[model samples]
Target: MTDDAMLTSKHALVTGGGTGIGLAIARALANEGAKVTITGRGQDVLDAVSGAGIHGAAMDVRDEASVNDTVANAISARGPVQICVPNAGIAEGHSVHKTNLSFWRNIMATNLDGAFLTIKACLPGMRDTDWGRVIAISSIAGLRGLPGAAAYSASKHGLIGLIRSLSEEYMGQPYTFNALCPGYVDTPIVDRNQDTIAQRTGMTKENARQLMIDANRHKRLIDADEVAAAALWLVGPGSHSINGQAIQIAGGQTA
Candidate 1:
């Protein structure tokens, strides 16, 4: 089938979809003729940004019951979710030693446990369907040690593990599992993090911004649309052969 034909009847769900990369992906899929559901804890943001068949739902991915219910509700309205993007996560750094129980658990709950539940809840429906995709949004830190972000790195690494294992379990199926590792996307998350970066590095706000810019090998902040495009490609016709892979959208630094 053609790429466009493959995506025409799909239902895609993007977690943390109120804004930033998640919203970008949701809209992109909807544009490609898929029913897209954007989930976030903030109903206001979701409502403000939704359009056409891009629906919004309030969901807290950290809660297991909420994850299950949200997935069930989405399926009830739009049939099975053929594309599941577990993008809801909290990204911040605390040294493993300095990370308290709440801090550590919070990261694990949203990043790791949330991904597990999101994928798990969606799988039964996917198994009943003919084709599906599970794409987890991870980070460059998931592949390597982040000096001050041990907890975040560990959580992301766990997400990667989840995708890898699922890919193996359904090896011969039409479903594929993958991870998107992005570095320093231009988003609200970065805006909130700039202050922390400035305070920690004793640098001006602009300098803190430059630090992240230079971290990307291409010397620019990744556009949210760029990541969305990669996701679109994965769910398209030619990408069925790609599975259990990390498609790094961080210019070249992640390679």
Candidate 2:
């Protein structure tokens, strides 16, 4: 296909596509002519975003059965999934002293295990095709430790590790695997985090929010489309050789 319709016959599956960064990427892929299946646990949220070239499915990435069933349904509806974005994840900051097994498990389940399941289910279809892309939405914490967010940081770190291993596993193949590590994106997750930060640190909500904004090198939250733009680049032209990379979206050096 031409660059104008590079994804004309492709099918893309994005988890947590109902809102935030995932939704932005779904829209971007659809805009490029790929049939997109945006999945979330809430059917209403998914349906609300379904239109144009984007469809919605209710699937919990934490469940193996749900992941498999949802991927099957997407294939039945839009053909093989040439693009997969495991963008669904939860972000919360907790000190190591306060982190428990349940908290650790939950973060790992949604962020790490979820990516594993999503990629495992989608790889077969991708392997059958001539070209495919797997883009995992990791975080800046994955590369550097974020104060008071030990569990969240660990989960994201594991995600990048998974992406790196897969990229090597398929080194000579047509499929490419990469992770996006963005700092303090402007999303619903950030809104919730601000509230948590306020409660935990006794800062006002606005101050808590500003804390994240200040974390970025540019002193602002990153737009969701900026992350989507990176994903589009990985799946778009000139990306075949850009595998196994953690593309940082922060304004400047994080470490």
Reference-based lDDT, each prediction = 0.89, 0.94
Best by lDDT: 2
What would the TM-scores of all predictions be? 0.96, 0.98
Give the TM-score (vs. native) of candidate 1: 0.96
- The 10-residue segment with the lowest total lDDT in model 1: 1-10
Worst 10 residues of 2 by lDDT: 1-10
Query: Which runs in model 2 stand beyond 4 Å of their true positions?
Result: 1-4
- What is the C-alpha lDDT profile of model 2 across 112-226, one tens digit per residue? 9999999999999999889999999999999999989898899999999999999999999999999999999999999999999898889999999999999999999999999
Stretches of candidate 1 off by over 4 Å are 1-6, 253-255
Q: How accurate is candidate 2 locally (lDDT)?
A: 0.94
Question: What lDDT does candidate 1 reach at residue 33?
Answer: 87
User: Positional deviation of 80 in candidate 2, in angstroms?
Assistant: 0.8
